[model samples]
Target: MSIKVGVIGAGGMAQYHIAGFKQAGAQIVAIADLNEAAAQAAAQKYGVAKAYGSIETMFAELPDLDAVTIIVPNKFHAPLAIQALEAGKHVFCEKPPAIDAAGVQQMKDAAEKAGKTLMFNFNNRARPESFAMKAYAEDGTIGRINSAQAKWIRRTGIPGFGGWFTNKDLAGGGPLIDLLHMVDLAMYLMDYPEPAYVLGQTFSDFIDDKNFKGPWGIPDAGGPTNVEAAAHGFVTFKSGQTLNLQVSWAELVKREEVSVVFQGTGAGGKIERLFGTDGLDETSIDSCELYTQEGGNSVNRSIVTEPCEDMGRSRSAANFIYTITGEEKPLNTPDQALSLMKVIDALYESAKSGKPVAC
Candidate 1:
């Protein structure tokens, strides 16, 4: 039977989820948004059977929802997911599961009590580069891991100064939350070690500036900008491996930088990505490369990119559906989300206190 899915948040991300659900052979029963017009439009565009102005009505009216995607802002992730799980539906949430660690825990507990899945969307884990690096790390092709460095720097991308993207109350944080793809990918590739601690710093120096605007933002004339525009942190795992991460929505740089590099005792590899017209197309996607000592000389070679039938967001959606339909199992569990949340929560705390925080 085709899974009956209802998606909340008729925003840009919801469109991707709608397409992905279709690709995964799930029937999109409804689209919900606070803006009823937006919900209607999305329902029509996605060929969904219904449009709801709120989750309450969606549940009260249509009780056949087998699954629901929580695509709303950071603040509502926990509550919405909890409600959905209580409703006995499988919940799939986008990245940065919640604003704080406690909220993620709540969602986790709720899912457990309901005997439902609480899969977090770390979609990049399925990307070619991320998948390849994971293989190298797990198979010991790179030996014991040493350290990892990843960054996603956007020179002038402050994502809607007045909207949820820039509002601390709405977005949770700036680049740390918005550009979590690279950071999450790197950590996922590293197998999400037990983080021991985090020392970090954040800055919102340019939030007041009207000159810098994001490539994708709803410029509402001018509004509040209360989140950090940049953040950098160092996380040390209990196993002694370390990860250094830096993310920025606005900076004084020539261009953007997005890469995940991992080092090990024996070999090292890196994947640098370039954005393209259609997201990360073949031309823009980086090749998985390895650097090591061959005989008496240094050698750098490219690994063959295996054919992946589904990847990125589509793969994530398909896998979620697969797990629900008993076709496959889930890779990103709520426990991993909770662990990742602990590190991020520590980073935010460390940034404010100017001290290292134990994760």
Candidate 2:
């Protein structure tokens, strides 16, 4: 039986997600967005059965929505996910999980109470380069990870300046949440360790400056301009592992970077996804390399990786359906997402206090 999925939010992210579900052979039965035109347009484009202006109305009318993909803004993640879970629908939420730790915890509790699956859309982890590196760590080739460095730096690329993306209250934080995919992939490659503390610094120099912004998202001017444009932080895991993270939305760098390099006791590995000068689409090359010793001599090996398992976004939809149908165990569980949220919460708190914060 094909699973019936109702997608919420009809933005660029939602387009990828809907295509993924369709490619996975799941029926995109309905869609809902605050913008009615967006909802209707997405529904028509994807051949969805119905479109609604709100999730409440969609759920009330369509009583058999098996799952929902929540791709709205950061602020709606918790409330919307909880609502869907309570309505007896499995929730597939986007990255960062929620605005803060408490909000994420509420989503987790609601999922548990409703006995529904709550999964995060950490699709980058499903990329070929990333999963290949993950295999090495799981196989213990990169034994007992001690330290790692990761960066997802974008030069002059802040999303929706003066809008929710640059508003602390609306977006939770800036680059910390916006470009979290890099660190999330790093943590996934390291097997999801429990973070013990975080020390972070955030800068908001270009929040109101259009010169250092991109032309991707719709700008909502006249909103708050009080969020960081970049963030640098380090997390100490309870298992004595550490990771350094540097992410930015605005900078003067020559190029953009989305990369992570892990150093461990046995071997080291790296995953890099590069973009062009314009930073619109990813460049053709992505590298996944492993460093180890062969016959007592050091060797740097390039791991051969295929394209992302079901194309770019389909893997996430496939994995979620597998979880629903008991074919595969969920990799992005609510507990795992909550762990990431704890680290995020600590990072913000540490930035505010100018001191290390316990997760």
Candidate 3:
């Protein structure tokens, strides 16, 4: 059976989801956005049959939709996902499932009541380099992991100056959410260990300063920006593993960068210089080098790059459909999303208080 999917946002990211869905052989049945013309344009572009100015109307018209993808602003994630789940549609929402813990909990409760699948799109997990790193960790190639470090740094990459991207209320935090791809990837490689505590800080000084010259050559229009341009955090896990993470939209660097290093008891390995272009046509070389603590020998492995596969968004969409059709187990349940949100909440609290917050 073809899975009928609806998209709730027609923005830049939505196009990626739409393409992934089409490539995965799912049906794009409907779409909705606050901007009706944008929704219509997306529907036409994707060959979807229906477009609506509101989600309520879209649900009413396409009641049989197998699943829906919520890609709207961060604030709307919880409400939109809850409504879809209550309507008996499985949901695949973008990362940082909700703006806060309370919203994420509500969405989880709704999914539970509806007995539906709810997935947060942690797309970074699907990258080839990420996959290879995860396999190495599980295979004990990295030994007993003790500490990990992940960083995503940019020279001057503030997104959508006057738009929701820079607005704290609309997008939550700036680089924390924008560059959370690394956070998700690092934690995942660490086997999603329970975070014992988090300590962090956020800085917005550069963004609002008039004399700021962005690292990426982006001009700094000095003005009030509500979001942080850079953030750093330390996370301690229940298994005694610790993670140090740094993310930034603007910095004193020349190019964008993302890297993860894992230190283990037996051996330590690192994946450095990882990132991808917008159209999926280009991606950073993912390389791993392993060093044995006991032997004092180093083995560097170059990860072969293949055509990037749209990591599981469409497959995740298909999984949602299969869950509804009784063909497969749920790919992402609401419980998982709630847990991810809790981590986000703790990270923010730790940042604000300059202390470790228990998760």
Top candidate on TM-score is 2
For TM-score, candidate 1 versus 2, the one ahead is 2
Better of 2 and 3 by TM-score: 2
Each prediction's TM-score versus the true structure? 0.93, 0.95, 0.87
lDDT of model 1 at position 215 = 59
Cα lDDT computed for each candidate against the true fold: 0.81, 0.83, 0.73
Whichever of 1 and 3 has more lDDT, that candidate is 1
Clashing pairs in 2: none
| lDDT (tens digit, per residue) of candidate 1 on 258-318 | 7888887879988776544223344354567899998999999887776443347767876
Residue 290 lDDT (model 1): 90
lDDT, candidate 2, at 61: 95
lDDT tens digits, residue span 1-359, model 2? 88899999987777778776766678888889999898999889888879999999999999988999998888999999999999999998887799998998999999999999999888877787776777788888889778899898888787776777877787888888877887887888778899999999888777677887775776667788788878899999988899999988887777788889989898988888776753566353578898988898999999988855332466776788788889788868887788888888888889889999999
**Cα displacement (Å) at residue 279, model 2:** 3.3
Question: At residue 62, what lDDT does model 1 achieve?
Answer: 88
Error of 1 at 337 (Å): 1.0
Ranking by TM-score: 2, 1, 3
Error of 2 at 261 (Å): 0.5
